[model samples]
Target: MPFSSSSSSSSSSSSPDSKYNLTSAIRAQTQFLTHAYTSHNLVIASYMKNMDNQPPRHEGSTFGHRVIHCDREEADRRLWNDYFSEYPKYSEAMFRRRFRMSRNLFIRIANVVKGHDNYFVQRNDRIGRLGLSTLQKVTAAFRVLAYGIPADEYIQIGESTTIESLKRFCRAIVDVFGERYLRAPDANDVARLLQIGEKRGFLGMLGSLDCMHWTWKNCPTAWAGQYAGRSREPTIILEVVADYDFWIWHAHFGMPGSNTGINVLEGSYLFSNLANGIAPPCHYVIQGQQYHTGYYLADGIYPKWSTLVQTIHEPRGPKKKLFAMMQEACRKDVERAFGVLQSRFAIVKGPTRFWDKCVLHDMMSSCIIMHTMIIEDERDEQADIQGWKEAPTPEVDIARDENIIFQEFLARHRQIKDKEAHYALCNALIEHLWE
Candidate 1:
């Protein structure tokens, strides 16, 4: 019992030492952890300092952007010295061929467009650098439409700028010239057309009707089935009625259907005013039967409607042969117009690169309007068109009750859709052409 007591006393005395040893070890570990944590913090601070030492970058964009110095003012100077100066480097014919318009006409168009849209006017960048001049912008847009090339082909003008310019230019042309140039045939116009038709052997023939197709390269995949016909190529159709002078009086575009003038004609506005009884007076006698409405000479694809006159398919007699020859010869007016239109604005001739249908519509409308303007300007140089221009516009009567007007409109609509009138007109035309 005394030995046990002595051992317990010894253990009790050594316990304090063992506890001190353990506490020292824990303190050492905590010190080491603190040092390691300080080192980690220092490393993180150094990494962040390195990050801050790098060059600042633009927000939402990466560093190392490229900049090409373009002396656009010099480009404008060169353009003026080459084309607009008193003694220019290019000839008038060269100017007309390259620009697809006269210098005066280009100037007039530029001035008008600049006035209509502020985008055409020259402006400064945020850095106070002068941007492209009016001449440069218009040239880019016009050349793109005239050549069907990429907009970046212009000297120093970027593709984005040129594209924007082309968009605005097309819109301005539509707003400025669409009303005056792209119009239905009025009384004077109908009279002049009838006079030309009389000389060509048809009495009430207004113009030739046809349709053309434009390949849509960027058509949406969802619409491939609807727009793609037998060719399996997505295309948009344009239906037009043009005269011998390349004047397109009626145009219905953007329908995806057969280019044979039948499907497109179903929804066309060619005879809207006529069927509504508000059309210009067109009274002409064919074989002792007077036709109060004019007709368009279409190919065999169109329906037998009084407003549209088609040629005989298999003519077994001499009269039909003569009529077919004359009709076919005259019906080429619209085709020739299509050829010239394609030749002028090669954009429509080539595959369309735009995806938006509304943009395509604007582009087409602008092209057609510009085409009609060119025709009028060119025809104005002739003495005969001047006489037609001098003809007085016919007066329209504004007096009519609503019921009577509606009745007349229905009557005209029925007359336009009359198959008997179509047959009678065809027979009379055959006899007239034979005579």
Candidate 2:
């Protein structure tokens, strides 16, 4: 019993010694780990401190530094007072040639924009220096439209600022005049157009329909396939309907150049109203037969719609030849309008530089609105100068019965896709033109 007790006492005393050795070893390992981490952190901090003391190897070139202008203040004064006030540096003719509008029109547009947005207002720069005046900003936008020149050349404004001004100007023009200029024909407009058509020997013609392509120089590489077509270049299509006086009545833009005019026509709003049964009622008599739908003179590419008249393909007979000649000549109205638009706004003449399609659309829309506005203004002035007066009463050939008109409209609607009606109308036109 005494030997067993002595052995137990010796083992219990050795257990404490083993536990103390194990705890001491663990404490030493933990201290070593902490010291190693601290050393690594110190090395990283020292390297960063050394880098902070080193000189920069390359410096970026700063732009928008003040350039010396000897007469900037005088030029500003002249633009603000002389040109804007009663006394001006340029004549009215010069103003029109330079900006494509009269001085009065320019001022009016400027004032309208300045009132709409603060961006058009002249404010102090961050350094408390005066920024560009409204005249300078709007003129910058006009110059871009007029010459298609880079914004940096003609004005002291930065390129970015000039671009913003142009975008804003176009947006403003559209906002202010879009409702009047870009509207669908009302009842009165339809009546006037019909009367004009009758005077031109086309009893029910509305206008000419055509398509134009505006080259896109900055199309994204990813979208190149969609926009680049048989033209071997990127382009955006503009489908237009223009009347005799070069007023653009409809503009459908942003179609990829890969598509044809026929494709554009298929998707256009030209037929939307007709399809929805909301088109303006057009009634006219040709060869004693009445047509309820007005027609547009299109090229060969357009479909055989009842409301479209295309030139005879390679006409052999004298009647067909005459019809072809008249149809083609009339179809040139839309082309002429496109040419005039490009000439007026050189931004449209050259390749478009913007990346966004919406910007290009707004730019085109604004140009067309301005073109129509100018046309109306000049037309009124010419009418006044020539002592032209409005007719007191318009002659109606035959008063159509309401029931008959409704039946005729239904018949026309049924023939929207009828190729036979198209050929019949063409034959009737040829006979009428020949007679």
True-vs-predicted CA distance for residue 2, candidate 1, Å = 39
How many clashing residue pairs are found in candidate 1?
A: 0
Highest lDDT among the candidates is held by which one?
1
Alpha-carbon RMSD to native, per candidate: 6.7, 5.9
Clashes of 2: 0
Off by over 4 Å in 2: 1-74, 80-82, 151-154, 381-414
The whole-model C-alpha lDDT of candidate 1 against the native structure comes to 0.85
**TM-score of each candidate?**
0.85, 0.79
Tell me the TM-score of model 1: 0.85
Show the lowest summed lDDT stretch of 10 residues, model 2: 383-392
Please provide, for model 1 over 1-435, each residue's C-alpha lDDT reduced to its tens digit, 9 standing for 90 to 100.
999999999999999999999999999999999999999999999999998998765443346665556778878888898788889999889889888888889999999999999998889988899989898999888888988875443456887888888899999998998888779988888888887788789998899999898999999999887888767899999989999899999888889843445668878888888777578888789788877788989899888998888888988899998998888999999999999999999999999999999888889999999898888778855544434433455466764699888887888888888999899899999888777
